[model samples]
Target: MLTGIVEIVPGVSLLKGRLSSHETTQMLQAEGLAESDLIPGKYEGILLLKAGAEVHFQDYNQEVLRALTAPNVAANTAASGQHAEGCTLRRPRYFAGDWTGLPCLLEKEGLLATYDVILSAETVYNLDSQRHLLKCIKQGLRPKVGQAWIAAKSYYFGVGGGTASFIQLVDRDGTFEVKAVDVIDDGASNKREILLLSFKA
Candidate 1:
């Protein structure tokens, strides 16, 4: 009975020839960016689609379904002492817009405060977009039971937005309680963390 929608943007055609991973890295290096650098409003950190990178709606839909239904699956199995029945998930509706404009967009679609959970990754690296992101989450999440899980690095090297700063913003807003559910430190890069946000009772 839980329905959901996800924003999707049509793939942009690469005007030039496709580049391999190494070639793309070299090109980004020429532009003063390493392979992992996200320049925010300049580069989104995704490789060129023309370089054989592809994103499918089905893949996104599966991920969303898994994230939202995993707990239910476990609970159902535990209660029944058997595997839960498989159910078909509805294809998520799609909209395209910038984070600053997403809340309004969702409102126009009659989806305001409708979601039980929201998931995002590597989206907090831009300091300028964090407020907008928070606004969208605040307006979209259903009351009490709604939650959002954001996965990002402990700090973004060049950009100012990180889990620490975002947590401060959440505290200032006074709308949600935020906690780190997981931390990953491989010593190979910046520490990563998954923060959970939920309405304060």
Candidate 2:
């Protein structure tokens, strides 16, 4: 989700543009991320968060977090006659780091292989990073009961990574069962799919 300031405004388009002038892009270029959105072992397409600067996806992230933490907020409000604001909630922990090594680090911190459900969106656009991403999921996701939901296009035209390719990888790995939970074929964009990966029984 390469969001921008406009994302904070209501009714704004969620379409993303190239990061031509963003400071993060410049910094990545300086660090040798020439033109590609991703460069393995060097830069992955994450924006650097600056102190005192509002993150582009902050609002969306907060909304999602709140929904996850208080899914019954509306029901509670109607039943108890209390407003949503009165409900006390504990926030989930947020972590940011390179995807390549994050799983190993979290494992050392006793956080790996603990998640029941993992979600990833639009991450399979680059062929180079898919293996690393899969590795991270394999390491962090709980065995047997854990599952990962990946949303990606059926075919990424230029970068050569997509749901089909990813499923092939998973099949070759032989550790997970891949299933297409949903498919989106709007005719305006590339065919997209939501894939579910779970450990083999």
For residue 14, give model 2's deviation from the true position in Å. Answer: 10
Worst lDDT run of 10 residues, candidate 1, spans 53-62
TM of each candidate vs. truth: 0.60, 0.61
Q: How many backbone clashes does candidate 2 have?
A: 0
Assess each prediction's global lDDT (C-alpha) against the native: 0.60, 0.60
What is the per-residue lDDT of model 2 for residues 1-201, given as tens digits with 9 covering 90 to 100?
Answer: 233322322222123323444744554555323443442222111111111111121111222323221232222223332323333322334444447867766778797888777778888877777888889889888888989999999998888999999999999989899999999999998899999999999
- Score candidate 2 by lDDT: 0.60
**Candidate 1 residue lDDT tens string, 1-201:** 223222222322111123467854554565223333332122111122212322111111222223333323232223231321343222234444456667777778788888777777887877777898899889988989989999999898888889999999999999999999999999998999999999999
- In model 1, where do residues sit more than 4 Å from their true spots? 1-85
C-alpha lDDT of residue 155 in model 2: 90
